[model samples]
Target: MEEQLFEATRAGSKRNDAGPSRGGGEMQSTTGATSLKLLLDTNAFIALEPTSTAVERGLEFGAELARLAAEGGHRLYLHEATRRDFARDHDLARRSAHLALAAKYPALSGIPKSALADLLTRLDLPAPPLSESNDAVDLEMLAAVGAAAVDYLVTDDARLRGRARRTGLAENVLPLAEAVQLLRDLSPRPLKPPPAVEHVLSYQLDPHDPIFDSLRDDYPGFDAWFAGVRRAHRPAWIIRHDDGRYAGVMLVKEETDTPYGLPGRLLKVSTLKVTDEAHGRRYGELLLKTLFNHAEHHSHDAIYVTVFERHATLVDLLTAFGFRDHGRSPVGELVLAKGRRPSVQDAALDPLKFHTTFGPPAIDTRAPFFVVPVEPRWHDVLFPDYPGQLSLLTGEHPYGNALRKAYLCNAPTRRVAPGSTLLFYRSRERSAVTVAGVVEDVHVSHLPEEVARYVGRRTVYTLEDITRLCRSARPVLTLLFRQDRLLEPAWSRGELKTAGVLNGHPQSITEVCNEEGRHWLQERLNEQR
Candidate 1:
């Protein structure tokens, strides 16, 4: 039976947007309960606007958010304050742009006077006096939430979020990313399997490949750049879809001389583009991830990109992955750079401080580590670069060795939690338990979309595989872990048996509760130290 759902709302935010349901719409819960109603804060709507400067470099950030909401059966609402904000803006051009985007969501109007009065009293704020003509809209926005006009408010403003939390509406307030993840969990889509990597061939691009034509707008001198890349023997990895079409492309070049003042081996991303059809599906993210791995393997001291200022979405993405603005390039383009080590202090403290940002997960010395077996097929992503073997792992992640994530649906992993040590065992030909790390966070949700949005930004899984995993009622558990330490002289299955750490072949995530098993694994790991 479906459980009853409830919503309480109250708000006076830095940026405000609210709306009522124009139609009963598709906002119905799969379990036949009331669906979540989301209101966009004014800044969110502003972000959707394409600036006059954003020409060929413009991004459709709004479309992706809308898609998630619609697919997840959530109704988008706009507070009447959004309209007032639009009208109050003195910049005619910017106001028009804001209005254009605002038109997409239905605007909510009319509020009960008693509800507004009650909300003001509860919030302990005075009603805007007649003298304060400019303040009524903001008060109205708060009243809308207080009256439960909408279940949640989405915003990017930090101050607004703080205010919401202070007023005991923390759960009702959400960041844009969190809002999308939540909605997806509430309304996950059906599954569709992705094509295997075996089907997609990888090859180096010749300087004269016609494929460069499509990228001319982004890279004006593509041919010249390609010649240099080819001469350096640095291939621009391209992934072809099953239909033998270009899915995405990425180009990287090692630069010794850069205006960004990146010393040593600095890698510059020259091109990263995905076909139009692959936009929301994460084709671009896949290629960019490959470029990161390539840079890491090549011993690049830093990675940087020269992007047009108009490409806000791309810039935001790079920033999210720890790229900092190194000011502007000689060509007047934005110079974003990311280094192996984040700060001078970190380098001074520990030479290999790549993943030390959060430090290692706290250790629970009293508990035994969980020994989980991973198949060879999934090893490339789950555990990259099996020593003495070629590393098929290609991707740039904010968390290097310090933090890694693994997706699980098994019974044992669901029981895993923060501070739990995990000893990973590689199955098949490798047939050894080699790496160990500590768990930092565990996310278990039945919605694939929720899992994807939360971790998909860094996952190795394709969209199809992620969607498929989320399709079933079985919960998808994503384990975020940190501080990976490789075990020297891997413990082979035979070795494990002789040591009494195993009785037979292990198939799932098994906890090492046996005292002997814990001692044996710890002894081996301690030797490396």
Candidate 2:
């Protein structure tokens, strides 16, 4: 069995290596030749080896990593300690065969025993007994990572990850799925954006797909309920990968009477599920964006969802967007609801709080407003819905898909308060204000890594882009905002100057502090509605 597996993997490697380059290297060359060094743990190494049984058993991320390495010119190495651990296997022939297989990759030198022991002590880990070679090897790998020997240490060990978190090395450790996503984010290739959300009848779906399995387990009569929905031809919203696999699904229905004593017409989120593979990619938030946009467009009074407490991530996301806990449902599920009404009381809330509470199309008119100048290149990606663009290249960018987005600039304007109105003025060819958003937060930083962590998945800018911006030694101002409206009949440069909204062609983020200009702009927005 060992020899057969080895031969099978060798054959698979040959097949993989024979494919044409996938433009990763070419893309990198255009962008200053950035590449990552990935250090794989023993389990990650085996799972990623071509044709390995582990890859067949749902370790598909490993295959993705291999492809990325071959195409992107990334270097993948195995820690020398992994080799020693493999040699200790009880099955002599299996051990020998695996050792030979491991020899295919370059080896990362192991840390010295004394240094490893000191590092373990510093991290508050007990030294492993002499007999426990595996534990010692794990310590060595983590020590190397802590010392910044590699860009990342890829592993799936829960305990090891826990230790990493405790020792402040969590950012350097990654599970296979997240590791794959990081590489994808850092890759220079132009990726296809995730598919747009589609509205379809319930009957059009396959209820037995793995995407629905968890929903079935959570609700006893889920299948029967779905069958009824199918018969009624209930409408649903879904997102799928290019290969036709479901990334997310949302089932919603309109309720005329208050189902839970909530006022006005309500849209109940009956089911919202994002596949495990899509968890960290923010597809749930994308689906929520779709749902919120639908409700606002259709003028629904409120939205609600009943989810169990065990789904904490989903619950947290809901609450973050101003969903309030309205107590428990009949089945003991937590009922979260958000109202569409913007009350006088909402005027006092901060920018972030106001937007979260009332959602889009419900901005605080009392807040200050600013006209932010954005270049044409960035305007297209940051606000893809702006009209007249020949083509919008989203590149599977999460920031483009998200209603909540970040913009980075080094303009003189600073201290834009949260809840402040942002008029995104597309400079150059378009030269008009095309989009509007509400500020959620503001951050100023000079370090690229700090800025990266601050904006996170919210910004369309890549690390390289941020690095370039920081090269000028000016502080990068990261503005986090939720897109509120796409202005139709966008206010042009000439019109803005005539209305006193701008004194001249704006080159930076400019405040619209003139009361007459603010009033005129407000009237225009109301007229557009």
Candidate 3:
């Protein structure tokens, strides 16, 4: 059956030398790095063709993929199943044309029946007799990914992606947009980091930009209100993409006369908008992170934003960070407020709850503390504000920009309770504890997809990195934590060892289980205050 299938699909197909070279299925680039093997599903394969009709419908993701493949020296391939899929097309001429077009790309080696069956079982798919050609092809492509036959299976099928996610292959499956983004991330580029949020005068903004279109539509006086803000020289934070387009903006003001009967000096978020193009990049969280950092740095008592109910995404993000709904504004917009002041009752709240409630720089003393050793490379990315390490350009990453971040490791120590205190001990040259954080959640998984989903945008590691980490045999420990503060006058390795906070240097996530060590660490923290 397999031999017949192969012969039937290859009858009129001819190989092209410029395409993937067929051997043991290993392709090498001129750069000496092993080329990343990408298996394209039927839809992606057709859509990615230079002359495909879909290109006219704004399928530029194909162009980006092609550029990445050319520049990055990656190899793209079509699976035998995809060829079979094309052969099944009812239009005889179209079928021949597609097979001819597909022939230009290298065909991935077919999976053996036993291996394919096992993969299907592992992926929780039913055995054979798939009613549709697309369904059969989807299973085959996913099976190829399951066998690690390809680095990634690129597809636009939402149902296929949903299945991959269910089967723990989410990390290996890429929708066109994410695939393009990932490829861009992997491609060689300049060393300049992504742009950080900039504090600018409100007058510097162009109100006519499409970013304000929604705001203008929602509020009749948005344009005039913005003009007044510009006239008053109100401060705003803006994030611009590398291409010099506005990605997000947040307009802010200081109000002494609290509306809705709120207390203390208030920092009102007048307008917070992230452009449609930057939707899934965590620019919203990035903007909020900047806002919270600004409010806390300037010692604002409370922070609030009045948002309409229509913006569900922003509302969910705000409430997740401990912003409470305090009734509605005079114009019917929902008022969400978060108190910045740490209170005595804060110590009683769980570690995660406490950080979210008070917005970091506050930890529950009642929680147990652990010293997690980190290398300088990761330490710099996770704690970008570390005094001496601030100069290191770790590049612009979502994890680095947000207060809520995840740490992935193969540490054997199980059971890091949520709300536990973590002292990030930066190892190597500057061997000392430099950062503190409170745990929000803890999970252990050997599956890369599960780890990726759990960490979401909170992780600094790429999916490729996560896959490699999972391949180490040991289960990956994901620590979801909120960064609390940079430890001032960082406790040195020598000091920690002397104080019994460490018996030498911590090689893994070590707990300060001893009373002496805990007490000594507490005294040091108290001294810093």
Candidate 4:
């Protein structure tokens, strides 16, 4: 939870409270202070265009953010680069309107040329020749954050956020929604919940259902495909709008009864669609995630989809999740596929020659086992099917590329190789060892770009979240592990301590080296039989 920045007084006011020290990329906020400043990205300014359609809900939200911040006594500004980006538009009238949007908020004269040049050389960074060039504008925007010109730089672009984090300005960066939330939380006005009509619900619909016929325009061959759909094929995952209309749908086909012919354990996305109203709301991403969870329950060799080239946004989203371009279909649709390589557990967790010797040495020659701590929230996101009332992680619950993945932040204690056992110690609220898995692959990087590339489209955390988590110099560890199974009855932390399997609560990774610890865990696994 974020530390409260002030104390409410009886006189309908607040006073500055002694809160945690803010440094090293920590969010800074104060009570009754006008120090908080926010800079909007070029796209955010464009989103505020007057002629935008209601379906561009993100644009409306972006405008609302500015109004809220202004009301909350916070200044909304933009880097001078924003003006240049807006001016780049060929449409003179549109460009003028965009510039007008920028005029609403004061512009920060971008980082001084001398300072930018010197810093570029000092940091061994490239300085584009033309100051008004796109690259130069990007650098200027980044320099605004690096020089602490703004308390928070708000943007809808994830790559820009990642870039800011790479340049050691993570805390200064905030996504549009997050920035709005922070401003609202610190606002004097009481926070009001969004209308119930905005909430979308997920439900399953039969493959051959008539409701799906409405989407035939998006999926030209959907009717023919539906006719060939297996009787036992998995039902389509649907998201319904608050008005009870369909917002999005994902039709998946798995198993030997394949759609695209390439047999043996395949998951094909025959159709994925989201209505205009839900375009920027991430409903489509949720449908894709639903497919991932379904694939986890079965052995699928690959997950593939045929999307039209015109669907650029959908294609970009797919590419973010590690989907590769596999030429085109016979009918000329773009084909993308994400192959699921077998994990160590899938091969029965072979101890000998488990992995080539690139990673950390095995704890024991027998098999590596460590009690890894997991935030209860993450535990539920990673193991959603686990028994209990699992709370949704977010509106777009389980964000990122969550296909058989786990994140290790703040410098995990140990770096185990593939085939090593990870006994999940679900900490805080639910203190227990409830799930176990084998590490399939590990990617370590201090560079957010490298980490993002490694994770591809299978991360559960946004780039902003990853930056927040890995604010320190400590490298981020991205573990690609398939959860083998969950313990029927979870082993409480105290129980493990009494059995000498765990000493105290392991703040970092704690190896289960003792023979007694292995025996105890083995007995729990035996219960499954």
**Candidate No. with top TM-score:** 2
Candidate 3, which segments miss by more than 4 Å at Cα? 1-192, 342-347, 391-398, 456-460, 523-529
For each of the candidates, the C-alpha root-mean-square deviation to the true structure, in angstroms, is: 10.5, 10.8, 11.0, 10.2
Candidate 4 backbone clash number: 6
Error of 3 at 458 (Å): 5.4
Give TM per candidate.
0.52, 0.71, 0.66, 0.56
Q: Per-residue lDDT for 1-529 in model 4, tens only?
A: 2111111100100111122212122222233332256677776655555555455546766777767765655667778777877888899988877777677677788365665665466456775548667667666776776565655677767666655645655445665655664554344442222111122222334444444665677668766666666444556656666566666677776545755454468888877877644543445555655665566557566788998876655775676455777778977888887765534553453642332111111112346677878776566555654667342332223322122455556545545766677787778787888877667656565543334323423344333444454456566555555455567578898999887789978777678878888777666654442
Q: Write the per-residue lDDT of candidate 1 for residues 248-347, one digit (tens) a residue.
A: 6676666758555677677888776555444334344445456555665576767788888665546645663557788887768898887763443643
Alpha-carbon local distance difference test for all models: 0.55, 0.70, 0.70, 0.57
Tell me how far the alpha carbon of residue 391 in candidate 1 is from the true structure, in angstroms, after superposition.
13
Per-residue lDDT over 1-529 for candidate 2, one digit per residue giving the tens place of the 0 to 100 score: 0000000000000011112322122223234444556789876887776434432432688888888776656678898878888888898877887799898888878455665666677677675646447667777787777654656788877677766765656656776776776666555557456457778888898787778988888889988898998887777888886678788998888886888899988899888998767755667777887788789778898999999977755776798688999999999999999998876776678766777788776666667888888777667667655567622233334446667677777765675977788998888777889988888767666654445444432334455665677665457666777777788878899988888899987777789988889988878765643
Q: Backbone clashes in each candidate structure, one number apiece? A: 10, 2, 0, 6
Model 2 segments more than 4 A misplaced: 1-58, 62-179, 390-398, 456-461, 523-529
Put down candidate 3 lDDT per residue, 407-485, tens digits, no spaces: 7777887758888989988777888899888887676767544554445323444445656676766777777777777
User: Candidates 3 and 4: which is better by lDDT?
Assistant: 3
Which pairs in model 2 have colliding backbones?
193-396, 351-419
Q: Which regions of candidate 4 are displaced past 4 Å?
A: 1-39, 49-58, 67-76, 84-101, 112-234, 255-263, 273-289, 308-325, 332-334, 341-385, 391-422, 426-431, 436-486, 489-500, 503-509, 513-529
Return the clash pairs for model 3, or none. none
Q: What is the lDDT of residue 401 in candidate 4?
A: 18
